[model samples]
Target: MSVIKELARIINEGVNTIQSKCDASGKPFPSLDEPYTPESDAVRIQVIADALPIIAAANQLIATLQIPAMSIIVASGYVHVSAAFATIAKANVVEALREAGPQGLHVKEIVEKIKKPMDPAKLARMLRICATYHIFREVAPDVFTNNRISSLLDKGKPLKEILAKPLEAFDESPGCAAFVDILIDESFKAAAVTQDHLMDPSTAFSDEPNQLPIQRAMHTNKALFEWYDEPGNELRRRRFNIAMKESVKFEVPGAILQGFDWGALPKGSKVVDVGGGIGGTTMALYDIHKHLRYVIQDREAVIKQAQQVWQTERPEALENDTLALQPHNFFEKQPVKDASVFLLRTVIHDWSDRYARTILTHLRAAAAPYTQLVLVDQVAPLACSEDGISDVPGATAPTAPPPLLPNFGLAGSMVYNLDIQMILLCGGEERTVLKISQLLSSAGWKLQRIARVPGNLLHKIIATPA
Candidate 1:
């Protein structure tokens, strides 16, 4: 059979496996609105694993089998990539129509309701594009409504919330909005000139914060945090906090809770949330492991805010001193010494090799001989070899089945994008398990274990003092 035909057969088999798994459990196939829950999520994971081969094979087959016209369309994807951000900026349009409900609104009516006036003709093209991408529904010409995906982008729920309020009431609770803003405001501009940074020897070789692509692109020597802390950057800092809070959704903090044997630690053991913002991840885990005492540490500004969060959401833990908020910077020596665990979620990836080493070194200094340091972030697969193994040190990544890309291909798209985000925004890059192990060793720690969070992209790099 031809390659396409074979791919089709593979897809059919994968679909059958998925359907069979669902049927055996006697549950409806998961929907976008109501996906598989914790109790019923295992089958979904299995089904996806079963289908990875078919899906990746289909992707490769389709690309290889494309006609000249289709290849040209692929060649012009840069336009589409550029336009995607433009479309996100036009999120207000989607929000206005979403407020109008599923019935949607006429182009002219939506044009007026939005904060900024948009031309009806131009709005039509935007809506048409969104509709083409299955974001909005064009039930009839010029009337658009929200579908499953667009609803997530609606105001107050996600990106729209932070963007809607750029300055006021800004103490960093917003997430999706702030993150989207970061992408549009700083990262996008820097991404456009990334090649320029690479080609320039000074900028390319330098991992110093002020010398990176983003610094050059924006014509500033301030590093990302430095820029956020500058005078007149209150709004920027607040949005960053909001974005960090929202990151809990993506980081899969629950994985750390379940992935680790927290119960193994003695009751009332300490867990220092290094660089914790608002104690969000700690709060989640605290709910499950109530026996442990926790300290949420960060810079003074956010530590103050985190106390307020603890007071409001978890007053008992705060009142009883079971959960404490401390103002401590990770760059300095850790203050809560000899803690049972040091948890840094989405922190290490934000720094370069030298910086990451420093952060680890500081943690190592404060850590007791028995203390475990948890580095929670994405563990990038350095490369996928023909054998389907990742070239990572001190650990192993899950191998994809035959006919599947070694690292799950499109399913791993966000990982690849985030790896670049590390470089574009900061002079950092995601590391393989091996790289992480090397870093840990240099910081006077040994790689103990790697824990995977089910249904999430983040990994737990557990280490101990050497």
Candidate 2:
């Protein structure tokens, strides 16, 4: 069959699966016109899984059908849409629209509600571009309302509250807004300078975190995290912290449970959460397996923040010694010498292999003979089939059926997009399983098994002392 025909068949199959699931559950198949909601139904979950290949096939079909030059031009012009998205999000347009209700508001009313100095015409244009991409909806000329995608950017705060304290705009947000803000502001800036950084002789061959495109773009000598610490960057730092916590929402609910079994450890066994920001993972684990003791480690600032959080959320854990927040750099010697498990959630992909190895070596040096290392990060896949590498035990790499890109094209683009984001922002790259295995081996750990979190792109790589 022709590629287009195959893609249409895939879409038909997926639509049928969705309809069947929705019909069985007696729930609608969710409309883009409505606001977003958390899906917990078994049928809803299955529908998402069924839809992945269809989305991939559809995107590939569009690319296949479009003229090569026009396709490239369209892709290149997406930066403008990204800028428009950031503008609307940063201006708190979503909150304004939410206040205006489903009837929507004119661009003039939106600007007035936001109490910003934005021009109504310019703002309308920005919203129009996003609406063209199916983010927001234009019910009438110069009037708009929040659709499912646009509503997700709502920070859930009153317009007045957000406007009163711009810096604290994301304080009560679910992290999506903050994540979008940071991605467009800093990550986007870094991406813009990536080619220049790569071509510059000073940083071309450099793997140092300080040599990242972000440093060059920001004209700072400090690494990305260090740059966030400088005075006057408080908002950036706060948003980043919030964004990290919000990232877990993208994973399957209870994805932490899908990985290595924390319940299997003996009661009161030590679980070191390396570079754990605000102890989110540890808190999640504590909720399920209260018998385990967790030591959440990070920079002093983050540890302080984690302490504040734990004090408010789980003071009993601190009082009973079930949880402890320790300020320790992973590159330095690990102080947790008897940990049964070292959990590194979304940590490894933020640094180059050289730095990642150093962090792991420190953990290995401090680990007990039977200690296990669990790495929660994306294992990037190649666009084509068979990424020429030996597989680790328990690792699964599923290829797509013929007529679609092996990695499922745009369905799996997040990992690849994040790979470049890491490179530009932190001199890191998302590794394939083989690369991860090799890095672990160099750091005195053997890759034991890999488990992909259901409904998420992240993988749990469990390793042991070599």
Candidate 3:
């Protein structure tokens, strides 16, 4: 068969496979344009995994055969500054438009409401770019309104403490807001000078967190978290912290319960959420397996907020002593000893190997022989599908069908993009299965299994003592 025919056949087969999987599971495919509760379709978790290679193979062929130059133009267009307009609007326009709601607002009216008046035309142009990206809507030629996507910025009405002011209302998408804010404010600045950071002889060998692109961009010797949360940078700190929960870059917190075998522990046992922010994931876990107790440990600020969250949201659990919020810097020591499990979600990926080792070592010190360390992070797959590598004894995901990049390239972009994010933000990166196995081995743990949460960008790695 001709190459075009072969490509078409492969793409068609992928579509059929995906549809069959969805039909068997009786769930709709996940969407970017519409909101769907992932928990609603628990059985269809593997559909995306099965569909990724198919999607990648077809997309690769399309890029190779059809409109190669046009594909480049479109891809480049996507990477451009439309996100900048979203950030600006979130700061300037979104709050102002809250009362206006979906009825719509004229650019002149929007300008009148602005704290700092800019030309209406300039604001309109900004909105136009934002609309092109589907963040806001352009109902008419010049008129605009909020869509579901943009409506997330609206956080209900303001309280009497600050009447009618939108910013005081709090953010509805704190996670998303943080993700965007960091991507724009911190990550972009660091990413722009990446080659400079890498190529500089001074920085080349430095795995020290201080020697990072983020450091160069902010002109601070302090680490990203320290500098970001310092005196006047409260807004920056708050946003990034919120982003971790909201953004998987995309509850990521709650979804993890699916992958974690919470019920396996004996009744009256404890689980320690090390570096757990707000105890959201722990809460999710507790909700499912009510028999177990959870200790949520994080920085003082996070623990303070968590106290209110537990008191307000899970007062019953707090009363029963089922959930406890404790202030801890995991780097210092594991205050909670011999717990059934130590859960680390998105923790190890944020630091360099040396620092990561420190975190594991702390856990190792606290761990009893039977205690399990559950790593809730991505297990990076190979980029070239055909290149076979020996799998660690137990960790696994669905194998991609032929012709797709082993890692599913753009389909599994969360893993790859975060790899870059780690390098730019801190001196860390994601690990391959082998690297993860080695890391666990060095930390004195053995890989047991990887439990993948359906539709979740991250998965849980269950391990025990070596």
Best model per lDDT: 2
Model 1, 411-457: lDDT tens digits are 66677788888888877777877678888899999888787765477
lDDT of 3 by residue, 217-269 (tens): 87889877668657877666555556664554243335676665678889988
Maximum-TM-score candidate = 2
Q: Give the TM-score of candidate 2.
A: 0.97
Task: Give each model's whole-structure lDDT.
Answer: 0.73, 0.86, 0.71
Candidate 3: residue 125 lDDT (0-100): 74
Residue pairs clashing, model 1: 159-176, 159-177, 172-242, 174-242, 393-434
Query: Per-residue lDDT tens digits of candidate 2, residues 1-466?
Result: 8878989999899888889878887888778898877862345565667878888999998998999999999899999999999889888899999989999999999988888899999999999999999999999999999998898898989999888888888874887888888888998888888888899999899999999888988999999888888998989987887777777776677888886777889988999999888877788889899989999998887777678778988899999989988989889999889999999988999999999999999999998998999999998887776644445655657777878889888988999988988888888889988898899999999998888765688888999999
| Candidate 2 clashing pairs, residues 3+ apart or interchain | none
How much is the lDDT of residue 294 in candidate 3?
88
* Predictions: Cα RMSD each: 3.7, 1.5, 3.9
TM-scores of all predicted structures? 0.87, 0.97, 0.84
Question: Ten residues in a row with the worst lDDT in model 3?
Answer: 159-168
Candidate 3: regions farther than 4 A off: 1-58, 65-79, 92-103, 113-116, 147-174, 247-254, 386-396
RMSD of 3: 3.9
